[model samples]
Target: MRYDTFLDEVLVKVKTYLAEDGTLASSRDSKSLAKTSDLKLPLEGSDLSSILVDIDDYLQKCVKTNHPNFMNPLWGGLNIAALAGEIIATLTNTSMYTFELAPLASLIERSILERMCEMVGFSNGGGTLTTGGSNGNMLGMLCARSRGEPLSQRRGIDGTKLAVYVSAESHYSVEMSANVLGIGLDNVIKVGCDDDGRMRPDKLVEEIERSIAEGQRPICVIATSGTTVRGAFDPLVELSEICHKNEIWLHVDAAWGGSCLFSIEHAKLMAGVELADSVCWDAHKLMGVPLICSAFLIKDLSLLRKVCSHGDAAHYLFHDETESDDLGRLSLQCGRRNDALKLFFAWRERGDSGWAKMVDGYMELAGHLESLVVEDPQLELMSSRQWTNVCFRFKAEEEEDASELNTEIRERLMQKGNYMISRSNIGEDVILRPVIANPGVTKESLEGLVAEVIAHGEDARRGIPSA
Candidate 1:
């Protein structure tokens, strides 16, 4: 087959699949297609026709993340232009390590990073793209550790006990960063959160004082902007003040909620983000770019350059300091894909206002879901959400366990191929967690989701078997 014909066929298949989705994927009884199917590598190479057929077969059982009914994960909504850019990058097969290799790509990445730093209100900001939010968080922690102890990198974080602070409701990546950076999990102190799931600045200050009294140095306080399940933005203004007063670094992990910068009305959610020493923003989340497009932005450019640049001066790849713009030296990743092209093309097409509207639209859908939960007698809102996630549950009889019933209802829904929303445990209650971030989804789709969950829950309470 011709290249154009092959590409057109694949696009048609994906477009058709996305348009008629009741849920992201048809339920397969908890078994994976990869294990069940005859997908094995052989010594012989398959023809183009056979390869295309295999592609179709693989997608048939795969979860359609781009589908409007997909309310499970943080990222949703696919941009055609950005997809085009991904395709173009793949065709070029270029890595974004050196300007000599990817001159245009390196420049585009710099432009995107500069714009993000400006949004973060950094005067002389600098940043590098990371694999994802986890990697970005690690980069922030590494930079903070370096700042706290200048010789720690060359030697080690020995003799001195260092501590890291974050909200109790922050993403687990904070703990992971500590483990990877040798700060140890015991020293990673989790501060308390307020009723709305934001980090309590008072508790943070108290924790820092306690750590200091114990002779443990509090190096950095990590704040969350849109937590994993609750979608809560930490009290950045208050936390920044505390960090500044303590003479410690403040890093805002805005992986999920950083898109607030795109919206003028909602940007106040991240007020005082400028005060943070460093910030991590994921364009792939609310901005709806492709996956793995996260930036670790630093307020001080010199710190980023000093902390990240540690190449042994590879002569062939990096000839001289003149080509300092080569991104590999400033990143943990070498031979990275051109992820910036996806964001750059999408930015050019959407512009700033367009991006803002996209964020507003997702938040509007989330608010609609919240209202639905509030009005329905069967639904109970687990947390007061300020962003895209709505955590709620279907009510059962007084004698029945609501948590168990909710779990049964979700499993039934998945088994019966009805709708797909994740379940999360808030304390003891298993709440239905729906992330309304898909731009193509509508109120009608969400209404159907509520109705189906209720219907399933009612049936399960009466001991009805799942379809």
Candidate 2:
């Protein structure tokens, strides 16, 4: 078939799938999936028809993330303009290294980064698009390391005992970044958090002082704007003051909650983000952009360039004319795709108001879900809804094995294919975590998910207990 016909067929399939859904996926079992596709590589090329058939089979087994039933992950639904930009990017197959190779693409990327920096309240800041939010978090630590020990970039650390600090509820990427940056995991300190999951500013100051007295050089403090499981925003305003007073690098990992910047009602969620030296934001999470679009924005453009790259890494690739226009000069990566275009086109189509509207809707939906849990007799709320995530526990009064029972309920949900909400361990309790990230998700669907979960828990308790 022609490429156009093939593309048309894929769109049709997507539309049909979006229109009809019961469970989130047809199958979530490893054994069933293993039989769905041939494992071994074929020696000879297969016909287009056979390959298309194989593609259909693969898609059939995939989780319908665009479906309203999908609430297991922090991303859902689709943005038409972002999908268009993705197709264009694929067709061009261009990298965002230099203007000579991708002039329009590089320009587009620069514009997006500049806009994001400004959104963070920077007057003249700059940044780069990272592979993902995790990589962006890593970039934050790398920059802090470079600034603290400039020689560490070339000669490496000499066991000076550099340290990193973050809230107890921050994303694990901060610790992973510490490991990657040669700051041993042992030196990565976890600060205390209050009941709302926001990092306590006083605890952060105490930790930094404690590290200093111990002769450890505290280089960075990562304040999470939105945590992975709780959808909690750290106390950025208070944390900023502590970091500034102590001369520590403050990086805000706002991957899941950064979309609040677009909403007039929710912008307070990210208040004082401007005080942070750097930030990591993912458009794919709350903005409805496609997957893998994350920004590592820094307050100082020159510092990012100095810390992340040397002036002349590749003479052959970096030409004089492209020097000023090149994006690779400041990026931690090379041969990067034009992922910015996905968010760029999506933002342009909807503009600020449109995106803010979506954010407002999600926030409203989250509140609604929280109320549903509050009214349900069989359910107990684990934590308050801070953003779009509503976490609760399934408890039939006096059930001591509720955690184990809840796990069984989740597994059964996956097996039954009626809903797909995830579960998380908040402290000691295992609670069901449902994030309202899907633009297409409805109030009725969310209510159904709650009812179905309670039903599953009731059923699990009736059977043999899960080990």
Candidate 3:
């Protein structure tokens, strides 16, 4: 078949899957089907009919993340403009290693990075786009380490006991990075958090002082702007003051809710982010861009280049002395995809106000979900609707067993492929975590979810004993 015909067939299937009710399947399942002996590429010059089975099998197992009911992970929904950009990017197959190879992509990434830096209040700031939040965090910590011990790049991290501090509730990637950078997990300190789940600034200050007292070098403090589990924001201003006084590098991981920067009302929650030396952000989360889109931005452009790259080997990437602003040199990876294309397209389509409107819609939906839980005595709102994550528990009705009932209810929902919501234990109470990151979700949809959950809970507890 012609390439155009093949493309048309695939697009048709994709549209059908998107309009359908359930997901096709996971990628792993698709790969398994594709790897079958009959599906292998031995029959190279085949007619359309020859590979039809393999094509169908591969497409059949693809997950339908664009479905409105897919609320399991933080990344949900699809942006049409971004999707079109992805198609263009794939067609071009541009390598972002140098400006010559990807002039448009290089300019786009730098532009977006600059815009993101300005959003964080970094007037003279610059940054690089990463594959995801984890890599972004890695970049921030690497920069912090370089700044803390300039000689570590050559002599390596001497047993000077250099350490990084984060809240107990911070993303696990912070600690994982500590291990990867040879800092050792023991050197990473976990600060305490308050009942609201926000990192306690007082405790952080005390911990840093104590670390210094014990002959440990407190080098960097990672303040999470939006945490993963509870969707909590740390006290940035308070933490900034402490980090500034001691000259410790401050980095903010706003991977999940960093898009709130576009929202004027909620933007204040991330105040003092300008004080951070570096920040890790994920555009894919709230921006509705494609997956694996994140960035690690730093206030000082020289810092990122100095620490991350050696300018001595700049002949290949930077020939023009006047224009040495290519992105590949600052990044860890060499042959990077033009991930910025989709993000740039989305930003262009939905300017500041449009993006803010999308975020506000999610916030409003979350608030509605909160109200729904409040109205029902059987369901208790676990925490306030901070960001778009709504944490609530299916409370026991008089003599009913709550945990077992909620667990069974969650299982039933997932089994039926109706609505995908998650469950977590907060202080021994089983709570449902529904994230309204998708703009397609409405108040009525959330209310219906609550009803389905409660209905399943009631059914599950028919003969179960009370705790």
| lDDT per residue (tens digit) for residues 1-467 in model 1 | 77788888888877776576544576475456556677689899866677678877767777777766778888887888888888898889988878888999999999999999999999789789898888888889988999999998888885249999988988888889899888988988998888888888889889999999999998989999999889999988888888888889999999999998899889999999999999999988878888978999999877777776665466767767646678877787767999999899999999999989988888888899899999999888999989999999998788999889999988887876656688888778898998976776789889988899888988898888876
* lDDT pick, better of 1 and 3: 1
Q: Please give, for residues 1-467, the per-residue lDDT of candidate 2 as tens digits.
A: 77778778777876676577644688766886787668778899766567667776767777888888788888988998999899889889987877888889888888999889889998698999988789989999888888788788888894457878888988888878888778878988999999988888888888888888999988898989889889899988898888788778899999988989989998999999999999999988888889879999998888788875664668877877767888889887777888988889999999988988999999999999999999988888888778998989888557458788788888888778878888799998888898999887999988898888877887787784433
Candidate 3 stretches with Cα past 4 Å from truth are 21-55, 310-323, 397-401, 463-467
TM-score between model 3 and native: 0.92
Q: How far off is model 1, as Cα RMSD? A: 1.7
List model 3 lDDT by residue over 1-467, tens digit each.
Answer: 88778778878876765577665234433465556635445645767755665667755665566666667778888898899889999999988878888987888998998889889988888888888888888888888899889988878885349889999878989987898888889889999988867889899889988988998998889988777767889989999999999999999999997888999899988988998999999989988898868989898888787775664476866665524756767878877888999999999999999999998888888888888889997788887657888888778776777776677777777766668877776657777888987766777778779888877777676754322
Ranking of all predicted structures according to lDDT, beginning with the best and ending with the worst: 1, 2, 3
lDDT over C-alpha atoms for residue 201 of model 3? 88
Better of 1 and 3 by TM-score: 1
Off by over 4 Å in 1: 1-5, 18-23, 29-36
Question: Model 2: how far is 67 from its true place, Å?
Answer: 1.0
Q: What would the TM-score be for candidate 2 when compared with the true structure?
A: 0.96
Candidate 2 colliding pairs: 23-417
